[model samples]
Target: MDVRISKRRTTGQMSVFELDALREAFRRSVRENNVTEVQWAEHAERFVKSMIRKESRGIQA
Candidate 1:
């Protein structure tokens, strides 16, 4: 699957409240998938690495 993320930059830091909300949403992702936190983190790591590799290949081409 090809997952594309836009390279848009946003200025300013998220407020504490917004940060907490994001945290809650992240936690919910794991809970909804019934995966342990460690497992979810590992999945994210692999996905990020794969994306990097794909980008590198494109650059080389």
Candidate 2:
């Protein structure tokens, strides 16, 4: 599947509470799925490339 992320910039940092929540979610995902950082990064790279290819073909995301 193709994934597209917005290029707009946000001004503020995440609150500590929000950061903790995200960290916990990530930990749970990793623990449950046995995912490594490298695998996650590679998957993200492939997803972006797919999105770019689809975009070049004039396909709406």
Cα lDDT listed for each candidate: 0.59, 0.57
Which digits, one per residue and each the tens of the lDDT, describe model 1 over residues 1-61? 2222222112334567856775675666657768776698785565457655875697566
TM-score of every candidate: 0.46, 0.41
Against the correct fold, how does model 2 do in TM-score? 0.41
Say which candidate scores most in lDDT: 1
lDDT of 1 at 19: 64
Per-residue lDDT tens digits of candidate 2, residues 1-61? 3222222113334567856775676566666767778787765465457645865586352
Per TM-score, the best of the predicted structures is 1
Which residue pairs show backbone clashes in model 1?
none
